[model samples]
Target chain A: MQKGEAFKIEVNELALEVTSHIVNSSEIFRIVFSDTRPPLVVIESLTNGRPFWTSVPQGRQKEAEFFGKLIEEKLKK
Target chain B: MCYYNGQKVSKTEFLKLLQLEKALKDFDFLNKELSTGFDYSLNAVVRPKEGEIDFDIVQMEWGFVPAYIRNREQLGKMRLGYKDSAGKFHPPLTTLNSTAEEMLKPGKIYREAALKRRCLVLSSGFFEWRHVNPLSKKTGLPLKATINYPYHITIKEHEYFYMAGIWQPFIDTQTGETVDTFAIVTTKANPLMEQIHNSKKRMPTILPDELAYEWIFGELSEERIQQIGSYQYDYREMDACTISKEFRASLDPTAPFAYEDLPAFELSL
Candidate 1:
């Protein structure tokens, strides 16, 4: 992915901006929320499509799922 | 060893200052305004994803709670410093900073996290204290009163920067709750830090902007990691000012005393 490329998704009143990049041979997705209390969620795919998520702030697990699904759907297309 | 750190700028200001605004896009998760103080939990910036070096500023418990601990009860016990069956008192795992030497060692607690979950702990500045006592002129003995000279240190050019860190995502087996935690990585003090943190002689790994990417994404060998960990940051690049001792007595983490400065003292033998 090119530098500075990003996309946005709105779900259940929460807006998430996402950017993808490859570091150390792994694809990493950074999802930033657009809320009063914005949380940053980082997702990396391991072997067999297993996902490794980091820094999903407290009380924001549902937001993570919504952002992940959006990213997954976009990747599928 | 950095017990107190301050971020004078809000997330927006930090992003703009670092030129990370384009990569981060928004700052909703961060606190709207700057809140500074000393605490066991801190809102730190991290880059956990590999492919793109972007920022993920999140609030993490400053102390590392190992994944094995099942509940807050056990965590509390550990925090109180454990006593073995043999009745010896051992220091509790107050894991605010994991030494660079320990992070690289095989079979160590931080080894896996060091290699995989590297992060950048953002801070505007950090606090350290020097222990000082005047010597008796004729007796050549130490004086009874010892003074702790506190100093606030920051990068001269940048308003904020990153400290090297490793993080873990911990799950409570009993409650099924997940929390992400991190510990700042420390190394032998640079000349500037040694003078301030006189007792411990250690300093947090402050990574320069140019090397932050390599720290997070580069495939580093053991030798390379050592070089990066122990690299002596230029003392001239930092600005350290002696601050009022009121910071040490204040219970409020956001106390205004942190902003007060005292006359600078020359370092001596």
Candidate 2:
């Protein structure tokens, strides 16, 4: 998906394989109650790999902020 | 400066390295090896009338310019070194990873190159990191460790290998000289690579010894890449051990380990 669009990620299960198929889907979840609401990201988690599903916003501002905090911490190295 | 499989090879060793041996004492060993890794450059501008293959070394940039940039600063900004490619300036999508599953479809640059302008990237070894331990819950410390792991799955000994690559010839907007740039093809990570490249579950599509030529010329059919994808060897088939290269005595294969140790983690799926 491009920068600001939201799409649902669908995970398929099979014998020994966990595949993610991005489905044609959308959601209207708002990050804040302000007039200009931020877009929410819906990412599907694959069962064969790491953690289960979690959503970040369409602009991914929170995710970006979290990553920025991580970088700042690592820079102290 | 890199080991193919496990054996260290120098520029002097390349020609002899290509000479594959059928068995010990085989007279045709040299010729067989030469045929596998050695091939002359073939491009529209360098097409041979009678058709000849001449294998030689040439310098090329690693990042592509898209044949659209007309500014020197913009071109320079795109130059990729290991650290530079990992920097904030480069977008995640542009950092040399576009999966075949995504690129095989129409309209992708990889699909375009695969259909028409396929080229080979010659290299001794590329790097991958294995997590030595899960991140410590208490300290929030990363246990990622760099390893000079060698490729040993498909060879009796160390031998140079080629990763499947595609290149585009672009004219430098300011210099007015033609330059070639390339990106390596990646696929779903094999079991051997899951521990390393732990962050991203992907690995480069390494061309097989017998199939390197076919892969380079787009002579390989879609069926071949698919079939080859199914044949990736397990980690057990490869000798995967972490060795330090940055710490003193780290480059020594016999050096004692100093990093955090964790139980072996294997990918089941």
Candidate 3:
């Protein structure tokens, strides 16, 4: 990773880190973004189970959505 | 100083992460091969702010300074030794690394900070010296040498690792310069380190991922802190390589240089 210039940093806390993995004879690069304490939205499942998903705060909603789209696009590739 | 460290984070990523573009021009260090010794040196350290679970990556001076020192001059005197009114000359104070067992004892200089100001020191690797008294060709007696072979040690497969550390903030009364200083906590050496750092028989408290997290966020009870502070990172998980005697000046400081006469380890890795 050092020679390849691959790097990973958490948006939640920006420590200088890099992560790399080899998959299917090809090197895959990923950047992981996380929130330390994210606001969660709880939803009632059909079987009365509570499932929670993270919510993006004001002004950062666009960044959250952008990352969501980026992940989706990467998955499609 | 046991922890002669290498913290080689590039400037571009560091600025982008910290959003410190304004300070970019003034930025230096974080790419140093060896970052601490008798003199002051800078290294990237992870410190948790008050009321914050997550930590910020900040550059802190490696030599710890106690808060009671009056000013910058006093700090110099305290570190380099100053003769007392009775004209007794004291030795230079070494605060680069603190003994994990002794740091928390009552009335200790590091006691208060160890309890409240725990932090993690980030390192690409650290350097330690091994003394080898080679037999003299003429007499077969040992020859005197100060620093023999130098070893650059790091955790295996870990690009960078965290060492347990305690930080203190110093405010200079004369210059009003407020800077964060830290001391790496060290414990009794594991077998591998027992060979490499033979003189001191001590090694930095390199924390694993889980323990590193708990050390920063766990309950601050004296026992818990001391337990983690005294952790001896398993020798099997470490990688030690002998570097050139001129490693501090070599282009590739960390590249392994094999010594033909370096003794084979009796203990298995």
Candidate 4:
């Protein structure tokens, strides 16, 4: 995906807003929870799927789990 | 410095252990997540109000992003170690662990956070690698090679302990996005940690249960902060063991957390 290409996906109770950024010649996909508190749950995944960096804010377990599963499902697709 | 950390307990268990079930009613984001490297986030307890030791745990990125980094461009430049010859924009140093000495020094990136924005990083255990060079057995000659043995360290008596930390809020000027990040405080390693973390001889400033309250809420001068930062826990109260090298390999969340009793290779002293 080109830099700034973004989209939103919703599955069941979780909603994710994914954005792409070009960092050092690699694409980093930063997927954040659309509905979350101050420290939102953000997953930074590489296009190659080698490194999946997930960040979950305090008090948002359900959102984090759903986000994780959604990323896994998307990767499979 | 602690790069990898493990928080094996659930939020309910952590709250019960810390006796914050009533004070903190709604927040339940903490879980059994393990970190192997940077760019990940962890939960930390911070005192947002003075005279109140009761605090709430918040998720913060492991690396501290200084406020001066206004946008993605600046972040990229800073990460690439960009700095003017006059020392403008600060040096490109790792923000994962801010040493106590560095925190006390004037004009340091973490000085303000050190004095004002202290917090407690909760962890069941932390990981560090020890460097060893051994002679070649086949050639019977000294080999020019070094092997890193990863160790998981934890307090002996406590299921979970607090490591002193400082946090900051960074806002992207362009997008107005905010991210809370933190850096673990480190001090001169105690006898045992010195042996384990031989290269740097630095260990996280792990506070005792009683001191945890003071670390978060107490008022003190720069000298007192330095003293608190330099305080060392007894090495006997801590434990360490070798873990699989896979801990250093990838960012897989499901990677094995098993500890090995012996190092993979024998070291020739």
Best by lDDT: 3
Model 2 alpha-carbon drift over 4 Å, by segment: A1-77, B1-56, B76-95, B132-156, B221-237, B245-262, B267-269
What is the RMSD of candidate 2? Answer: 26.8
The DockQ scores of all candidates, in the order shown, are 0.03, 0.01, 0.05, 0.02
Per-residue lDDT of A1-77 in model 3, one digit per residue for the tens? Answer: 11355444334444323333332112223344344533221111111122111111113334334444443344466
- Provide the TM-score for each candidate, comma-separated: 0.63, 0.48, 0.72, 0.62
lDDT of 2 by residue, A1-77 (tens): 12343223222421111112222122112222113434333232222332222233223434334433333343356
Native interface contact recovery, all models: 0.00, 0.00, 0.00, 0.00
- Point to the candidate with the largest TM-score: 3
The CAPRI quality class of candidate 3 comes to incorrect
**Sorted by lDDT, highest first, which candidate order results?**
3, 4, 1, 2
Q: Write the per-residue lDDT of candidate 1 for residues B112-134, one digit (tens) a residue.
A: 87777877777767888777666
For every candidate, how close is chain A to the native chain A in TM-score? 0.60, 0.25, 0.28, 0.46
Q: Report the C-alpha displacement of residue B178, candidate 4, in angstroms.
A: 1.5
lDDT for residue A3 in candidate 3, whole number 0-100: 30
Q: What is the lDDT of residue B153 in candidate 3?
A: 97
Candidate 1, residue A28: lDDT: 53
Candidate 3 Cα misplacement greater than 4 A, ranges: A1-77, B1-31, B135-147
Q: Which 10 consecutive positions of candidate 4 chain B have the poorest summed lDDT?
A: B1-10
- Please give, for residues B15-131, the per-residue lDDT of candidate 4 as tens digits: 332333322233344334466435545655554455553466667878788878898678766656676778776656578888887787978889999899888887767888788
* Candidate 2 lDDT tens digits, B1-269: 32222334432222222222111123222112111111222211111111322132333455544555565466545443223554645632252544656655766656665555544554434455554445667888865653333221232233345556656667756778777656666777777677666778687676554445445433557666544433353445344444454422233433334345444556574
TM-score of the second chain in candidate 1: 0.78
Candidate 4: misplaced stretches above 4 Å? Answer: A1-77, B1-19, B22-28, B80-92, B138-142, B248-269
